[model samples]
Target: MLKHILISVISNDKPGVVEAIAETVSDNGGNWLESSLSQLAGKFAGVIRVSVSPEQQEQLQSALSQLIEHGIWIKTEHIDADSAPKSDTTNAYIHALGPDRSGIVRELSRALAQHKINMAYLETALTSMPYSGDPLFDATGQLELPEGVDIPQLHDILDEIANNLALDLSLSETPFE
Candidate 1:
């Protein structure tokens, strides 16, 4: 029988980091399933899901630990069962842009939480405006809305936040399948 393992790895950014990790998993009889990895601030960090036979689990762990000597840190968690996906049928895409500032995410997230909206995907970036060279903050995300929630009211709430924060905010409904 195979068991799923959730693993996180972080190390100084360099070539061959991913190749090394993939080799480690493959050498231990584990199949690399899904992962999200990025290089930020000179460090490579990622979380990956893999499946291996129950007997190979410990061996995989030991092999992964060998990476520590090469400046990579590993953490592993065993998943006993998988949870079903949420069935909220309504989805919305949200976009916001503003001059860089603190607390924008916190405030907007608080409003979404109050409306019981689950954020399905969120991506944020900070870059300088093309002509002005001023720092600009931009964010985009998908939100799942619970049934019977008033979307116009949610818009009003977001509008209030935009006014207060001096940002532009927009929300559009995603077509139902």
Candidate 2:
């Protein structure tokens, strides 16, 4: 039997961070399943899913823990496939941009919650606008809507938010690649 685990890690931004994680997994007879990683504010952070034989779970976890000595801190959670969240029936990619300001994420999340929509993943950043050098907010989200919420209705909600916040927003189906 294989034990599935989710690991989240954070460390100072540097090369070989990924290599360290990959090597640790490979050395433990684990299969590296899927991961999403990023660098921000000079820090490296990500979540990874891996699978290893039940017998190797403890040894593997201990080995991963040893990485803290090298400045990489990790947290692990063991999970089962059957216990995963229910799959969403509809998914869309949403992008938003406007002048940088507070409460943008809060408003967007509140709207989604009122409509019972789920945000699967979201990335947001503050950036500088070209020519003007104005502070701009950029955001992208992967949203999951359940069976009863139609896309057009969701669009209307987002449209209202954009108008109120002076933002440019767009939604589209996830691209195939």
Candidate 3:
């Protein structure tokens, strides 16, 4: 039987970080499943899923621990595949941009939570505006909304937040490719 595991890795940003991780997983006979990786503030961070034979679990974990010598910190968790829940929800992509300020995420999340929406993926970045050179914040995410949720109602709530925060926000059924 295959054992599923979720692994998190963090290290100082550098080339070969991903190569090192892939090598470690392959060396232990683990099949890389899915992953989300990013570099932030000079740190390489990622979460990944891998599957291997039940007997190789310990061996895989032990080999992964060796990554410490290379400056990578690894944490592993075993997943009960059987306990994974199934969801029948619709997804929408949300994009928000405005002057860099606090509480943008907080207000957006509050509104989504009130409507029973969940963020499947979210990315936020700070950049400089073209002419003003002022700091701007941009947030993009895929949200999962429960069945029968009112789309128009959600938009109205978000509009209120945008108006209060001086932000521009939009939602779409399709995510930008």
Candidate 4:
């Protein structure tokens, strides 16, 4: 039987950091599956999904723990079972952008929470506009709306928030692959 797990790593950024973590997983008979990694504020942060034989599960966990001595902090959660995508929900893609400022995420996330919307993943970044050189805030994420929530309802909520925050927001139902 195969065991699935999610591992989150945070450490000072440096060369060979990913290689070291990957090598440890390989040595422990773990198969790297999916990952989202990035360098932020001079640190390497990422979440990796991996699978291993049930027999090697403990060994893999132990090996991952030992990485802390090398300045790599890791937290692992063993998944009990694979989660099938939900059918009673509306999945959509969201893009939000505006001038870089504080409280954008808090406001938007708060609004989503108030409406019981589930955010699958959200990535935000600060970037400069090409010609203007002004700092801009960009966010992209996947949202799962409850069955009763329609696209128009979601758009209305997002539109209100965007107007208040002076953001350009877009939301579209995700076409199934």
Please report the candidate that would top TM-score against the real structure: 3
Best by lDDT: 3
| Candidate 3 structure quality by residue, lDDT tens digits, 1-177 | 799999999999999999998999999999999899999999999999999999889999999999999999999999975644467799899999999898999999989988889988899999999999999999999999889999999989989999999999999999955
Off by more than 4 A, model 2: 175-177
Q: State every prediction's TM-score relative to the real structure.
A: 0.88, 0.93, 0.95, 0.90
Model 2 C-alpha lDDT versus the unseen true structure: 0.91
TM-score of the candidate numbered 1? Answer: 0.88
After the best TM-score superposition of candidate 2, give how far the Cα of residue 13 lies from its true spot, in angstroms: 0.8
* Candidate 1 worst ten-residue window by lDDT: 80-89
Candidate with better TM-score, 2 vs 4? 2
Q: After superposition, how far is residue 159 of candidate 3 from its true place, in Å?
A: 0.3
Q: Give candidate 2's TM-score.
A: 0.93
lDDT of 4 by residue, 24-107 (tens): 999999999999999999999999999999999999999999999999999999985566464687788888889988899998
Taken over the whole model, the C-alpha lDDT of each candidate is 0.89, 0.91, 0.92, 0.89
lDDT of 1 by residue, 1-177 (tens): 689999999999999899999999999999998898998889999999999998999999899989998888999999853643657558899999988899999999999999888887777889888899999999999988888989889989999999999889999875222
Displacement of the residue 2 alpha carbon in candidate 4, Å: 1.4
Candidate 2 residue lDDT tens string, 1-177: 789999999999999999999999999988999999999999999999999999999988999999999999999999894565776568888899999888899999999989888898899989999999999999999888888887888899999999999999888897322
Q: Model 3: which ten-residue window has the lowest total lDDT? A: 80-89
Evaluated at residue 113, the lDDT of candidate 3 is 89
Error of 2 at 131 (Å): 1.6
Superposed model 3: Cα runs more than 4 Å off: 82-84
